[model samples]
Target: MSWLVTGGAGYIGAHVVRALVDDGESVVVYDDLSTGSAERIPEGVPLVVGSVLDRSALDAAIRDNAVTGVVHIAAKKQVGESVEQPLHYYRENVTGLQTLLEAMASAGVGRLVFSSSAAVYGMPDVDLVTEDTPCLPMSPYGETKLVGEWLIAAAARAHGIRAASLRYFNVAGAAAPELSDSGVFNLIPMVFERLEAGEAPRVFGDDYATPDGTCVRDYIHVADIASAHLAAARRLADFPEGTALTPSTSDAGRAARSGRWSTASSRSPAGRTSAGHEPSVTRQVSLADRARELLGWSARHDLDDMIESAWQGWRRRHG
Candidate 1:
């Protein structure tokens, strides 16, 4: 079966495309090249340079490519930017899904895997989120993602399509040597880039309740996330009689649905209120559980390993 990967030229989507190709799966990429780079997608994979919001383009691409499954990853993801431009977030994240769903119905593609986010949890009161937490999204970005998941569920129930939403946390690390995100967002990469430039890596928020006042986060390697998507796709295929829809198995998404996982802080790279507070290590191990139960997957690389490997890769590519 052919897979249509929206935003396949962006960071996480690019890695997913590479993984699918490596596993001998056929892939067709749909990206507008707004934030996605043409060079980021591996050579030879078909690319449709269009937006997911454009139903005509989406329908044509899905039909021409014979795309049986879709992995929707095209959405505006910057929390701060979403706050600054809520309309843009709603238009891209919410309306975009509606357009894709309409196109999918028209084209007869019955299965979908959506890339949701842990930001739906906002700041919870509990540290470890299960799959049943009440959603309290803080930013327009998170709200859009939550709404996207809701749309998937609604469409599935109404149209008899099967779907799985994969909620992701701090998605870091690179899968291919040639594919690196040069974006200035995200803390780890920002730290690496600054340190590489011989500048002190800035840490944010040193005055919270944790050991290190800096906000603690559950960082998952992008590769593991891709594996989860693959598993979700497989599960949807393997389930008997076709289950209508299910939320992501990730802890944060679970918490959002069940109101169990709570506790949040504004995570930024430029340092929070204080510059000298101790680091607050994340206590949630949701992704690990997902790796075990959902995909039979395990993160072979830790944060330090990912950092060092990326550092070397950056040196090789840039230096």
Candidate 2:
């Protein structure tokens, strides 16, 4: 089956595209190259440069490529920027997805693997957040993701589309130096930038209520993220036709750790020390039980693996 990977040139998207291709699946890349580089896309993979908002472009790519499924990964994902430009976030993340769905429906494409975020459960007060955690998004970016899930669910119910919304936690690392995340918006890259500048990494808000007084989060490897997409895509491809699959929530993350600095310190190439204490924030485990039972999938990489791989990518780009 041919899969159209939207944003296939971006950090995580590029990894997903490679994984799909390595599995011997026919793949096509649809990206605008705004934040993504065309070079990241593997050789021989057809890349259709276009925005998700452009229906004509999306239609042409889907029809021409004979796309049977879609892995929607394109989005404006900055939290702070979403706060400053809520409309743009909604337009790009929410409206853009709507446009994609409409084009997919019109083209008779019925399978989707949506790239969602843990931000939908913003500031969970539980000890371990599961798929049932109540969604209370803290930022516009989070809101857009939550809304995107809603849209997917609605479309699935109405159009008999097979879909899964993978709510990813902190994604880090790289399968290769070229595939490493280049943005400094994430904690790993942010710390790498600070260390490269010969400065101490800043630990944000160490005063949060917890055991050590800093926030805890789950970080997962980018390669694992790509594997998850492949698993989900395969599941949808083989699902019985006309059977409506509810848009279920699937979480993906590593074991929870306290403080961005604590997580960063464990993997810092220079072995830098962290100043913040660990917080009591709820462990954001990705609740992979459903994925395991349904898709027979689970993460294989750990924190050290993620950090070391990410650091290698950082050095490759910065040096």
Candidate 3:
């Protein structure tokens, strides 16, 4: 069956599209190109340049392309920006998802693979965040994701839709240099930009009670994200209608879903904070236990691989 991938031209989206195409899936890209690039679309994949908010366009794309499933990745995804522009985030993320779901229902499409986030957990105090963890999101972006999951669940129950939500954190690295992330929002790219500017990488928050007095974080490779999406997409068609699942991690071993993975000062390239305080290191193993069992998916990249690939991408773009 043909699949429509929203935001397929973005860094992560491009990688997801490539993974799908490489797997021999018939694909179509639906994007507004706001933060996405046209150059990222695969050579043979047809692109429908439009916003997810436009239901008419979405309907047309699904109908004309014979889409039976969708991988929804288009959203306003910045935590800080979501705080500053809550209305915009709610509209674009929440409302945009609603519009897409409506279009999907109208077009008789029942399979969906939604891109959720660990941000929905919002700094949980537990050592491991399972699917049963209470999703107490702190920021607008995280709230939108949690709400999006709820929306997907509601639709699944009422409309016989089959869906899955993939929750992840700290996406880094790329499958290729050209597919690398161009934003400086995440930890790695932020460090890359700071060092390139002849300045020390800045680490925020110094009040955590951890060993290094720094907050802990979990990281995943973008390629892993794409693979998880691929796995979810392929598995959805086989599940019974109204079935729903949420996979919390990708690849590695057991992920550091709980707080305080390690001493930050030694684990990352941003060795020391500007004030000479020790930065924290992440303790990510691979909390994707559910993903492995449900979709037979696991992350292949490690922390070092993530950093090195991202470094390669930075050099290619900045040099």
Candidate 4:
């Protein structure tokens, strides 16, 4: 079946496209190339240079491609920048979603996989967050994401669409040589870039409440994230015939009935200090609870393995 990948030229979107191609799925890419690169899209996929805000463009793409489903990954996603420009954030993230949903309804495409964020949890009171976690976004970026999910839910109810909002954490790693570089907004790429420049990536705070005295986060590998999207898509394609659910159907209704969670082992608490007394910088391994249970997904790359591969890629490309 043909799939529409919005933002297919961006970091995660590009990888998802590659994964779909590798799975022998026909794919079409739609990207405005604001922060995305046309070069990042694989040569075989049909590419449309367009924005989600343009309902006419989206409707034409969907009708032309006979798009069976959509994986919506387009949005402005810089946290600090979102704080600085909240209106633009709302327009791009929220209003743009409105445009996409309307076009999807007009085109009669119902299944969607939304690229959501752990940022929706916005620095949760607890370290490990579940899907049920209260969304208390601290920044405009997070707030817009929360609003986007709500809009998707509303659209689904009103329009007979079913969606999976994958609440991703820090997505890192690369898929192939043609894949794009990690965006400047993400920390792992920033760290790798700084290190490539022969500098130690700065650690932000070393006095956090975690065992290592640094903030810990769920660092998910990009390949694993792609796998989850595919799984969600397949599940949507195989939905039991004649279910009358409209778009308002909760995520619990159409896809991801359960989840799988796995965590990379945390660094030894003993590694908290180097001889210079700097706290050991580390992020928590994501427990793949939802991916495993709901989508039958689990992560293949652990933190150490991901770091090694990222460093290797950086060295090969820049050295």
The global C-alpha lDDT for each of the candidates, from Candidate 1 onward, is 0.72, 0.82, 0.82, 0.69
Q: Model 4: runs farther than 4 Å from truth? A: 180-182, 238-287, 316-319
lDDT of 1 by residue, 1-319 (tens): 7999999999888988888888888999999989988888888999999988898899899999999989999999999899999999999999999999999888888889899987887766666665576678889999998899888888887776788887767766677656666576876556656655555455445455555434455666677677777777777776533344434433232211101111111221332243554443334435346435755555554564445555555655667
lDDT of 4 by residue, 1-319 (tens): 7899999998789888988888998899999999888888888788999988998999999999999789999999988899899999999999888899899888878888888876776665553456666678878998888888888887777877877787777766676544535455665556666544555455555565566455555665677778777877777755543222111111121111001111111221111121344343243323446666666666676665555555555555666
Tell me the alpha-carbon RMSD of every candidate. 6.2, 3.3, 3.9, 7.1
Error of 1 at 33 (Å): 0.8
Residue 37 lDDT in model 3? Answer: 92
Q: Per model, how many backbone clashes are there?
A: 27, 2, 12, 21
What is the clash tally of candidate 3?
A: 12
Worst 10 residues of 3 by lDDT: 256-265
**For model 2, how does the per-residue alpha-carbon lDDT over 1-319 read when each residue is reduced to its tens digit?**
8999999999999999999999999999999999999999999999999999999999999999999999999999999899999999999999999999999899999999999988998878776667788999999999999999999888887887888888878888899999999888888888778766666666655565567555667778889889988888888867765343322233344554434443454434433445553343544554666667777778888888888898888879978
**Poorly placed runs, candidate 2 (over 4 Å):** 208-211, 238-283
Query: On a 0 to 100 scale, what is the lDDT of residue 155 in model 4?
Result: 79
Candidate 3 vs. true structure, TM-score: 0.90
Residue 317 CA error for candidate 1 (Å)? 4.8
Worst 10 residues of 4 by lDDT: 253-262
Q: What TM-score number comes out for model 2? A: 0.90
Runs of candidate 1 with Cα error greater than 4 angstroms are 240-291
Q: Candidate 3: deviation at residue 128, Å?
A: 1.7
Judged by lDDT against the true structure, how good is candidate 1? Answer: 0.72
